[model samples]
Target: MSSSTELTEKKVFLLKSLDGVIFEVEESVAVQLEVIRELIEGDCARPFISLYNVTSEILALVIEYCKHHAETCSGGTSATIADEDLKTFDNEFMNVDENILLELCSAADYLDIKSLFELTCRTLASLIKDRTIIEVRKMFNVENDFSVVEEKAVRKEFAWAFK
Candidate 1:
């Protein structure tokens, strides 16, 4: 059951992504996006807030995440996502391709969603942690940019990292 405050605060905001797609989100969800929270607070979001940096696909995912978090944190049961636990939902949410995960991380940073940013960063760290330099370079498809001597110097400078 929703509290009287929750029921009374039924204002909806429209968020327009870079792809020209718009999403309607409730106040609860909107506050979670720190980048737009000022607009909501100042009543500037009466018109749709344009997210110039985030694409529609990523924006949708952010909204979904915020909604789920809001529902769960408010002690309200969310019937969405099969009523999955947040940890399970977060695991599934981060199961996208590496490219998509990078995009999501970038979007989360741009949108200033702290939880989403941390989750994405943690997921990415897990993937890269304990991997060798060559393996990581291969994973990111990054060609070696350093000459042999420069590489040796840098490796020697951070010798502990090489170990």
Candidate 2:
């Protein structure tokens, strides 16, 4: 095979968010974004992949996640690390309050990082699943955009929860 073909075969892409944040990710991981990978494999000459819809902050988080996973896969560290350490890292990484978590979920989804997207979604779901409506609203900073009557209607809809 030609060198360019080999390079393309081994090479991955780094995508930049609209706000100019860059993320270096492996081709294997980037391929998870099927459309982008198809374009890349088809020899689209775009130097930098642009994610127009994603913000820099969210992109940064996605980069962090992809970088970590890439490192793990590349054998940077032995797999001998204790489960506790892994759990601690996850906990610390997700320690941010609800709004940031929601943003991370959105970013993960946009980046097509299925595991991270699921992790964030599951975490958010778990957090709100057992909480009262008032608590959920406070956690998400969701203003009571509903009219008084609308609010009452919703409360009535979930009357079984109150009981």
- Candidates in order: C-alpha RMSD to true structure: 4.8, 4.5
Model 1 Cα displacement at 38 (Å)?
A: 0.9
Model 1 lDDT per residue over 1-163, tens place: 8889987778899999999999999999999989889999999996799999988988888888999888777765556644467888799889988888888899889989998999999999999998988988987789999999999998998799766
- Tens digits of per-residue lDDT for model 2, 1-163: 6687776676757788888887776676676564376677886726878888788887776666655655565655556663444556566778776888998887777667776777799889988887987898887777779999998899898789788
Among all windows of ten consecutive residues in candidate 2, which has the lowest summed lDDT? 80-89
Clashing pairs in 1: none
> Which regions of candidate 2 are displaced past 4 Å?
1-12, 32-35, 74-89, 138-158
Number of the top candidate by lDDT? Answer: 1
Candidate 1 clash total?
0
TM-score on alpha carbons, each prediction: 0.81, 0.69
Off by over 4 Å in 1: 1-9, 77-84, 138-143, 157-163
